[model samples]
Target: MAMIELPDDKPVRHPEYVYMDYARHLSGRLRRTITGPMWHGPSLREALDGINAADAVERPIRSMQTIWEIVLHVTARAERARLRMDGLALDEPTPEEDWPRIPIPCTAAAWEYSQAQMATAYRSMAVRVCEVMSSGFLKVVEKQSYNIATMSDGVAEHGAYHAGQIVLLRKEIHSRRPNGAHVTDLLW
Candidate 1:
């Protein structure tokens, strides 16, 4: 059989309708998924609403990550994306750097700091995205398997995906409360 050689350059994936303000679009999405009054339900920040440091650190099941760990993970990923957008040319994060270690003696202050850190990372990434959008995908998209546009979309998707996990975790925690309190009993 004869072997066929593939071309080095793959086809570009510019969308049919160009986004004039794509930066703002993705940035708003990032914000909504992070903290919201989203139409479907609570955002990531909303999911964590009223949860204290103890609850953030509480592992409902031995196998699952604590909310605090999840927050740090999300923040790290966002920061990674921002760095890449900023032209750092980073590869994937190492396994040890994947999920950050939650600090010992986790206090209310630490929890708040984690949340704030998450917000700052997202905001910074979002601002960098504006520059990417303004610059367009011509030269940029070629370098990466996934371009800025797709990566931005992934960020939004990732946040919402984790937000759902946080929601389920909350229900599990609430269900196990001493009084048998149910998250199902109330709107979270």
Candidate 2:
């Protein structure tokens, strides 16, 4: 099939690309930080693995959340926003409300299962977003109720904030290890 070329005079819109860019940056940073066995660093898979290993007791500490929780929260937020970006609604009729907490697994097996589910959700959002980018459906600025600039800024800022938190969490976890003798072990 012959490819059709549009006029170069007008700028093309691509909100999905905009969002995809933010996701790429966010995911990259997460993957690179948290490191170990099932808990290796520098990738999304490893980050989640490390997060899952977090102790049940150490998981929910006020502003300091377990890694799994953080991943779930980000995934849930992204999924909800993506749905709205695609012109979808929440299941059933309720007032526009907060994003629901994704139920996580209590035991190891359940934790892995929940992690897989969370991964699926995150991957789904990535796929949908990429699809929107390639299909050009996200090209129009009006297609986004919040527009590309606002959406992009929100994603960037939120991702960075959470990423910073994860880094702090990892440092705290590492510091508490049995052989974790030195203060510099985590700091420097």
Q: Which stretches of candidate 2 lie over 4 Å from their true place?
A: 1-43, 53-61, 89-105, 134-145, 148-160, 181-188
Find the 10 residues in a row with the least total lDDT in model 2: 33-42
How many Å off is the CA of 96 in candidate 1? Answer: 1.9
Candidate 1, residue 27: CA error in Å?
1.5
The top-ranked prediction according to TM-score is: 1
- Tell me the lDDT of model 1 at 107: 89
lDDT of 2 by residue, 86-113 (tens): 7564453232233334355456776576
* TM-scores, each model vs. reference: 0.82, 0.55
Model 2 Cα RMSD, 1 decimal: 7.1
TM-score of 2: 0.55
Candidate 2's displacement at residue 89, Å, is: 4.2
